[model samples]
Structure formats: structure tokens, C-alpha cells
Target: MFLVESKGGAIACMLFSLLFLGTWPAVLAFLERRGRLPQHTYLDYSITNLLAAVIIALTLGQMGDDKPGMPNFITQLYQDNWPSVLFAMVGGVVLSIGNLSTQYAWALVGLSVVEVVSASITVVIGTTLNYFLDDKINKAYILFPGVACFLIAVILGSLVHSSNASDNKKKLSHLSSGYEDKVVYISLLFLSWNKGASKDPENGKEVKVPAQFGTAEYLIELEDKRSIKVFDRSIWLGLAITFFSGICFSLFSPAFNLATNDQFHLLKKGVPHLVVYTAFFYFSVCCFVVAIVLNITFLYHPILNLPKSSIKAYIADSKGRGWALLAGLLCGFGNGLQFMGGQAAGYAAADAVQALPLVSTFWAVLLFGEYRKSSRRTYILLVSMLLMFVVAVAFLERRGRLPQHTYLDYSITNLLAAVIIALTLGQMGDAKPGMPNFLTQLHQDNWPCVLFAMVGGVVLSIGNLSTQYAWALVGLSVVEVVGSSITVVIGTTLNYFLDDKINKADNLFPGVACFLIAVILGSLVHSSNASDNKKKLSYLSSGFEDKAGKIAFDSNKGASVDPEKGRQTKEVAQFGTAEYLIELENKRSIKVLDKGIWLGLTITFFSGICFSMFSPAFNLATNDQFHLLQKGIPHLMVYTAFFYFSACCFVVAIVLNIIFLYYPILNLPKSSFKAYLADSEGRGWALLAGFLCGFGNGLQFMGGQAAGYAAADAVQALPLVSTFWAILLFGEYRKSSRRTYVLLVSMLLMFIVAVGILMASSGHRK
Candidate 1:
């Protein structure tokens, strides 16, 4: 609490930074529905490293080094207007906390009124307190208007809530109910199936009700296939908390700015500008890293526990205006604002007093309507929050506390923000409303995935720290606005392509419009001068081809052989040569594939081959390259490009996994991670695929990490390895198709490319 004051709302501003940062966390929640798979869980989120950084920065910003250093933004804000800034920031934090506290009321009450009630209550109390605390009575109009706004918010929330309830009740008459609400529809089905068993007299006839047009048998026999998949409230609560925390996180930019600006102002002058900027920059990096990673894991929490394939809705319902689009806009602008503010000012302030549940809860209630009885509470909360936020703006303005208008000058930037926000909104709407995103798929029942997810969580913590810097550098809205926009726009486009049905819709008004827009956007992006510059930058492309030719030649005939002249072809190769072998020219020169690509792939491929062949190649190449044999570098280095690729795969895998995770949560049967193993139907031979995958990964890990360059050079003997493995192991050849053969040839070409890049970089005497 004291730190909040010291930080001058930077911590509060983090609410926004953390908000957009929550996409991954939401995804994690969707994942829990899928069973059998070890959940993608990360422990890093529990730790708030950026929050710690904020505390430190806030405290340090306040006290200064005391000797003589200070950041100018802080000094500027503090020296010119300490009182205005302090009071305004304090007001923001308090108001934001008020908004954050009753955030869930949107679901409990109604969107319109939840904010009103919360805000009215808060403002009323705040006004009363202001009479004594600030030595000024609140303006009657502002105070009364807040109350009225709260009332209006309440009325709207109630109306919308009740209307929704009626619709739900009617719908519920035909659907399955969970533990909370019991429905007798399914049992009736069994009863109606029986003919003339009880009520019918000696004839195969159906019983009937007086008012019912259909027979009693028909009433019970209605073939309703609707069911509801429910989530554990405990899990939901956790997800909600994370969501709330994200809203609170959004305010960090403005809040911190208010806190640190004053401190920087008061400082005398020993602090270097670099130190000031660096403090915020490092803070941002840490915050962002944490936020990014935690976001991923948090999203997995729900789907990991859900019944498979339950999130999909069996619907004849009309599609309404996309709410996800709104969320994306919020995320993008929110992030962009933080970066802008933090960059411009020495501090970033965050406070989410009015942002809670607004975007997300809106979707939860309207789209799914799962909260049940809280319809009233949700209304109240929404009403109060709205009123409070509105009053907050007015009150803030009345106090004349605007951060000396920094956003107006740049039209291009603002336009960029708008388009990004719009594009993102559609994307967010298309997201799988369930949890346990693709990243969690990378996690197996074993420890590798667990370890990676855990490490990922740590990275998330660090990223959250980066957000603080984003705020200090840019502004709160900038980060969310820009980042969310990017995510949403891309996601929306992908969603179009991801679903065939959705793509079909592209022929309509908004759909066609979206497609054309995308095309134009693509053109803008591609037609830019940068595209040409990118082509000109390809001077090394052809050189790689020639080098590939050489490697292919050596591997084909053996001229690239070692000069030791001792025994016959020794398997023990040297490190330099191993690295060199990968780069040698071949039948297919390095011209197209290039060295870097081959090196990455080679490690990705037969890394295990390298491990076993390590000692064999030891004599062929230089000791300097295979130096790992003496030490433990072998074990450590192997995980490099291999695992990073896993992270990349998670990005796509989450998409498929979400489908698997969602269908189960929606109570759809046959939804499972095993589905990921299959092609179209559930026909993928798991044992075989697993072995192939495992073999592929193990080789990469052991060979890349453990083998010296010389030992790795042993891979130059692909022909020998291929021949032996091909002939000896029936398993390897059993699945070999024409495609596989083609791919192998490509790999051969790539190997040569790798050698050439190395050679070119080496500057040969020739």
C-alpha cells in the first residue's frame, strides 16, 4: 500500500499492462477440459517479480540515491506540480481499486448497473471523505450525477439481466443442467420411449395432457440434443481472479508515472539520464517477460481439467456483434498506451478502477450466460463501475490533473492505433472461449514439458517486468492497444482460414468487407519499400548454394575425408569438420537452403545420431570444436534450437489443442489430445509416431548439446547412416512414402548448403 503511494500509481498502471498480457492466461484456463494429457502448468505466475521491481523503483524513485542523481521526467512532474500530481494519482489508485474490487459484479448484477452501483457507492463515500480529507466539499452536480448514473446503470443492467434470464429459462427447458440447476428433461426421454405401458388402455397408444397438442409420449420423446458442460467453480474463480488481476495491472503506467514523476522532480542531480531510463527499461523487460509467460500458463488452467470437446456450442442462435473484437481493441490500445507513457515519462502508472470485467465479463454473460443467479449482482456491479469510472473522469478533470496532453500531436500513430484496435476486436471474438491453449500441448505427462512450462512461467514473470518498461517508455493504452490489435487482427485472419465455414461467410457484407480489408492490409504491408530492401539483402543466398555443392560432393565420393591417413574411414570426427561437413557443397548447392537453415534442421533431425557417432568422429575434426567431451557442455548445449522450436510449435498447437480442449468442455464426446496425434479421423498410430517424435527430439538434444563439432561431423556420413538404418530397421522404412524420399533429398541438399555458409564466412585461401 505504501509502495503504491511511493510508486505514484505506476503499480496501479500495471493493471493495463497486465490486462492485455492475460491472453495466454485465459488460454490456459480453456485447456483444463481435456483429460489424459498432463496439463500445461507453470509455477512462475505465482511470483510477482515485476511487482517487486515496481516496489523497488517506486521506493528508489522517491528517496533517490540522495547524493545527486535524478531522471528529468520525474523531476519535471514533481518540481512543477507536486500537489496536483500526487492528489490525482492517489485519487486514481483509490478509484481503480474500487472498480477492481467489485469487478465480477458484471456477471452477478448487470453490465449497465454494476459499474454504477460500485462507482456511486465509492464516489458517495469519496465525496464525503473529500469534504474532510481534501478540505473541500464535492460539487453537488458531480456527486448527484454519479448517483443518477449509478441508478441508470442499475436499471439497464437489471433489464438486460432479466431479459437474458428469461431467454435462458426458455432455453433451459430443453437443455441439460449441471449441479447447480437440475433439469428433468433427460429422464423424461426414457419415460416417453415406452408405449402403452402405464396410461394407455390395452392399445399401443400414448398418454396425453389436456393442454398439450402432442401426446404425452411425444412430449417426452422430443429429440433434444442440447447439453451443458460445466466447469468447477473453483477453477473458474481462479481464472476470474487472474482476469481481475489483469485489469488491475492495466493502470500501472499512469499510476507509476504519478508516483515516480514526483520523486524524480525532487531529486537534486547525481542520477544519470541513462540510469533513469534504464531503471524503467529493465523494469519493463522484467514485467513483460513475466506477463507473457504467465499469460500462457494461466490460460491452460481451465482446459487441463475439463471434459474433452465440451466448449463447442450446438447452436441455431443468431450471431450478434462480435464482443471479442472489443476485447482485442482494449488489449491493443491498453498495451500501446503503457509503452507510450512509460517511454515518455520516467514512470508508468496503472489503475484499473473502471476496466474490470467490462470486456471479458461482457462476453462471459452475453455469449455463454453461465453465471446463473448473479444476473442481478452483475447488473449492480456493472452500473456502479460505469458510474464510478465516469465520475472518476469528471472528478479527475475537475481537479485539472491531466498529464500535460501528450497524445494529440501524432495523427499517424493514432490512426494506426484505431485500425489495429478494430482488427483485433474481430480476432478476440473468434478465440476459443475455452481454455488450455496450444502451448500446454507441448507439456507431456513427463517432466520436459513441465520443465519448459515452468521455465516459460519464469519468462512470463520477466515479461511482466518488461511491461513496466513499456509503460515507462510508451504509455498504458499504447501497449494494450497496439499489442492487442496485432494479436486480434492476426487471430481474426487466422480464424477465417482456420474454419472452413467461417471462410464461407466471407462472401457476405462484413465477411466480404473483412476479406477485402485483409487483402488491402496485406498489400500495404508487402508493397512497402521494405519488401524491396529485404530482397537486396540476399547476397549470401547464392554463396550458400555453392557451398552445398561442395558438401554434397564430399559426402557423395569422400574427397572431404580427413588427412590423418591412418586407418580407413574413421567415424570419430572433429568439431570444426563436423560443423564444416554440415556446411559443405553438394549435388544441391547451399544456394537455396543456406547454412543456418541446415544447421538448425540438422540439429533438429538426427541429433541422436550425432550422440552415438560422437566418439567415432572425434579423430576426424578439430578438438577445439568438440571441446564439450572433456567438460559437461554436451548435455547443456543440446536443448538449444530444439526446444525453442517446441515453443514455436506451441503457438500453432494451441489452436488445435483449443479445439480439443473446447469440445470436451462443451461436453462433446471424442475430444482428446490423442486427436492431435491423428490425421482427420482417430487413426494415427500413436506408438509409431511417438517413437519417431522421440527419436527425432532425443537426437537433437544429445547430439547438439553433447557432441563436439568433430563428433557432429560424423553426420557427414548420412549415406552410411541412412543405408544401415534403412536396411536394418524395418520400422524406419515401413512408413517411407514418396514424400519422405523427397524430403530426404531436400535434407541432403540442405547439408551441402550448411557447409558452404561456413566456408564463405571462413574466407578460404582459394
Candidate 2:
């Protein structure tokens, strides 16, 4: 059987599983919203769900040469492993029930809320159990912290839902009272035939109804289009079911863990532990059995006063059969991948994927428009909840304990260390023994230079913002290379002239030529990678088109294709290999698809220009090359200039980010200042990032003042760090064509050579 031995491979599996699992719920929800019977949908889903397991058994389960300890899937089928098999079956049963409960809960609670709550509960209970079962492979400090984050996210999610519901209630009340005086007309149309009207009678004439939130009219429209009758249900009922589902979900993973590992020594001595494939196959079979029995029972005797259905009715219902089938395939494969990953990594770490609410919230916003026009408080809670989930997942993904104390503790310790070093090791000799420090000097003179420093900060802020978008558009490696190269070539040249050409001209000019060459190679790399991605997208589109044709044929014979069906078809086409790219685009606050590559390049160029100016501006602030200040005024020290620079940078960044929250460019969703203030997640990390940037910039300026400023531009080699992370963490260049890889390597090499040459030209300032 195939095995994922490497940590990276296991991580890849878990991430893919997370995407697939998160997506299937949205599919099922969509079908339900389109009025497809849950009974029929589940039955259709069950068939493909079992089929997916069988497909895995035949393919990955039997691929490698069989060994004694780890038998192939088919061989294990005949072995005497009923004890482990029972455990697997039990896990399947629990998972099936959890899925069934969620179908109803989704209608009562919002999709995002339900997902967050259930996932949080699952992580809290299931991850702990799995940690013990896996012999505590996961670090308790990191794992528990992640679990705590999820718990906080759960509370925030609940508050967000409560606030949003209150908003809807108020909207409906106002809407009802506003139209109370209008001439009323209630038409008794056939419930099955009429699609419902969006008009209100006024003065014996039909008037178009305004957009609604939660009026009786809106409820009726929802009831007409939904399979489950949830208009009269209380939110309490949903929460109760959600809790139950979470409990069930929490147990299933542990049961599966026992089945595969036999960690408790439940089976007899001779019976080998069940492999992942055998366990997964049995698990799926039992899950399919449970789903079939329950859904068939529900068909004959419906709940929530839903119309009764029969086996015959279910067979005849083809309205959303394709989607239901697709959801099953997604869920089945998702579960298999999760199990495979759990077997390689500890199941406790694999539980990180329970942060699926992050993905669900993306779909909820993009597809269902769940939080559109929500209250400021609701938006704030929603963003905070998502941020907490992200942090929690990051913590879970870490493989080991932190080296020292907590991040905050280490940061504080470092600060104290720096202060001690500065007081002792950084003392000046007798020549400047009585001189005041830079901070005191700031108040005495060179106040006008602070303006230049603040201007530098403004330019840096703009460049930083632009680079963020550029990273998403052009890959990180290219963006870093091009942006850094621009800074070195332009900013370094300006600094050399500003410093009265103290640096060696021959070496500096050669370094500038190297940077220009690196820039060209960076552009070429981006173009090649873009072409590769386009080809991949084209292949996915072609395959999906064929599937769409079959769907159209089925629709023609079974049911008339409506606009909703058309939209679903279009969305489904974006699934498969390109799903990650599509999901990333949807999840981002900024929307940039219409302009694509050119827009990214434009932003990068603009950022490069901004970046190119900041250094020169700072140089002028410290050296007073333009003599803008009075002759008697002392030139600003590095520390004084940096203090003004960072202060202005902070102000500009806050103002712009806040503005973007409300009046965002690139078609981003609207936000408010309240939401900005409400975001508690990652705030500490954000402060840390700002602190590091300020400290680093101050040090760079200090070094440049002693040596030639042009040599200090070598810090622009930051692309080296960024590229390493882009490849290792984000998987930026995976599966790219040979040509793209070649250009990428060439660009990096040229950039390194250029940085080294620039540093070699360093000259001592008099």
C-alpha cells in the first residue's frame, strides 16, 4: 500500500483534506437551498461516498508490493481483524450521524456559525483524545494553546451570530412597520405552482417590493426554496443539534485512531493492526449503510413537517443529483485524505483542519452572501472569529515546542538584552564623553529634518501596502526580486551622489548592472510561471466543460435549467485542480481577477518607485545634502530621524488601513472602524512586526551613516528570506515548468551576486 512517510507529504494531505471537507458542506447546503429533498440528496450522496472508498481501495490501497506487517488492502479484507473492523464501523456510524445532524442545524444556525462551533468543539474534545491515543506525539504547549484559540473563536462566532440575528430582526420590524399603511393585497396562489411574488399591492396597483431581511414575506420565499422547513424552528434547537453533532464528530476520530493503531491492545496478539486503507474502506461501508438506513427512514416519515417522500420519489428526483453526488465524492475523498494524513502525522496535529470554518466562511460570503450589509458589531465579531481560527490552525501546524519561553517573553527578554548591550558596549570614547544622546539632541536641533523623515515614512508605507498585493498577483519570489532590485538600483545610485560619491564607482556601477539584469530575469520568471498556471487552468476547464455537457443533458430530460442551476454549474466548473486558486481568490478581501497580471506588475512597479525614494529621503534627512535646514542647525542623528520616520509610518498605515476598511479599492467587501477595533486576533503579532521593522530600519540607517549609504542598500537582499519562506511555507514554485524554474534560479543568483558586489564597494565616511 502507498504511505506518506515525510512530514511535508502528510501536511500536504491534511491541507487538501481541509479544502475538500470544507467545500462539500457548501455543496449540500446549496442543493438544500434549491429545494432538493434532503432524503434524496443523502441517498445519492451515499452511493458515491461508498464508491469513493472502493476507488481508493483499488488504486492507492493496492499499488505497492505487499509486505508482512503492512498487507495490501485486498489481503486485509480476508484477515481476522473483526475487533479493529468493529471500531472502524463504529467511527463511520458516528460520523454519519454527525453529518445528518448538521444538515438540519445549518438551516437554523448560519453556516459559518454552526461550522465554527462544531469545529471548535471537535478540536477541544477530539484533539485531546487523539493526542493521548497517539502517545502524545503532539506538543502539549502548542496543541493546548491552539485548542484555547479555537475556544475563543467559538465564543466570538456565537456573538457574531447573535448580533447579526438581532440586526435582521430590527430590519424586518422596520420594514413591516414602514409598509403597514399601504393598501394590502394577499393572493392565495397554489403553493407548488407559484414561485412567489416580489411585489406588494399599493392603491390597487402592483408595486415592486424592496429588499427584505426577515419579514414574513421573506420567510415564505425561503420556505418555498428550501427542502427543510426551518421557518418556525428556534435557534436553540439548532444549537442543541450542533452540540450533539460536535460530540459525535469528536468521538469518530478517536475511534478510527484505535482501529488503525490498536493503541489500547484491544485486538488479540496475532491479529495485525488494520492499515489505513482497510480501515477507511470498512469505515465508509458502515457510514454508507447508516446514511442509507436513516435517509430511507426519513423518506417514509419526514421530520420538521417536511413532505413525506418514498424510494420511488427519491429515484425520480434528479433536480440536484449531480451536485449531491459530487458532494459525496468530495466528502469521501476528504475523509480518506484526513485518515491518511493522521496516520503519518499524529491525529492530534491533523485536527488542525477542524478550522474548516475559515473555508466555510469564505463560501458563505462569496456564494450565499451571508453577512452582506451586516451590522458593524456583527462584522467585527465575524472578522475576529476568523482571525482566531487562523492563529489556532497555525499553532497546531507547528511540529515542536518553542525553543525558549513564549513569543512575548522572548521579545521582552531581547529588548532588555539590547538595552544592556547599548549601555555598556556602545559607550563613546572621551571625544564625545559629555555629548547628549540622539533622543536629547532631537529636542535641541534638526527639527526641520523630521519632515524629511516623515515623508520617507509615508513613501515606505505606500510601498509596503503595494507589495502585499503584488505578492498575491506576481509570486512572492518575483515580487521580492523586482522590488528589491529597484530599491538597490535607484535608491543606491541616489545615495551615492547624496553622500558626495564616497563609494567606489566601478564596483557600484557593476552591481547596479547586475541588479538590472536580475530585474529582467525576475520578469521572465513571472511570465513563465503565469503561462504554466494558465495551462493548468485550461486543462481543468476543458474537463469541467465535458462534465457540464453531461449535466446539461441530464437537466434537459429531468428538470428545466434555471438561473440558479446555471450559476451552480459555473461554480462547479471552478472545482478540481484549480480549486485552491479559486478559493484563495474568494478568501482575499481584495478582488483583482479582472486585471490579472498587468495589474500586479503595475502595483509592483509603483511599489518599487516608492521603495526607491524612501532611502534617499532618509539619507537627506540625516546628511542635509540639500541644506534645507538653517546652517547653524545640527544634522539629525539616525535614532532621531528613525523615531520620526516610524511614528509617521504608523500613523499613515493606520489611517490607510482604516480607510480601506470602509472605502476599499479593488472591489473588496466593505468594513468599518468598529470591526478594525474589534479584531483581537493577531494584534500582538502585528505590534511585534511593527516593532521589528522600526528597530531594523534604525540599525540600517546607523550603519549607512558610518559607512557609505550605497553599501547599506545590501539589506535589499531581503528577497533571500522571502523566497525561502515562499517556497517552504506557501509552495510557490511547485510543479512549475522547467523554463520557469530556470528563470527563477537565474534571478536569485543574479540578485545575490549584485548584493555582494554592492557590499564590496563599501567606503568609510570621513
Best by lDDT: 2
Give the range of the ten consecutive residues with the poorest summed lDDT in model 1. Answer: 400-409
Q: Candidate 2: global Cα-lDDT?
A: 0.75
Expressed as tens digits, the lDDT of each residue in 645-697 for candidate 2 is 76677667666766666676665556665654444333333333343455566
How close is every model to the real structure, measured as TM-score?
Answer: 0.28, 0.53
Model 2, 37: alpha-carbon shift in Å? 1.5
Error of model 1, residue 138, in angstroms: 8.4
The number of clashing residue pairs in each candidate reads: 248, 0
1-766: candidate 1 lDDT, tens digit per residue: 1122222234224334534533322322222212111111221221232343344345544454332334433443334343334433443343233233333333233333333334334333333333333223334444455444544543444454445444344444553454234336546555444533456677856665321222323323332221113211232343343334334433444333434344334434532322333234343434445444433443444342332321122021112112222332343334433433333322211122333334344334433333444345545544454433443333321211111111111111223322333234323433233222223322323233233323432332222223322322222222222222222233333323222222223222232233223323322222231222223323433443454444453443433455686534524223223222333211111122222322322222222222222222211111123233333212111222233333333333344334534353212234344433222210111111222233333342344223322222223233333333323321222223444444334433333343232222211111
In order, the Cα lDDT scores of the candidates are 0.32, 0.75
The list of candidate 2 runs beyond 4 A from truth reads 175-220, 397-766
Candidate 1 off by > 4 Å = 1-144, 151-163, 174-417, 422-766
Best by TM-score: 2
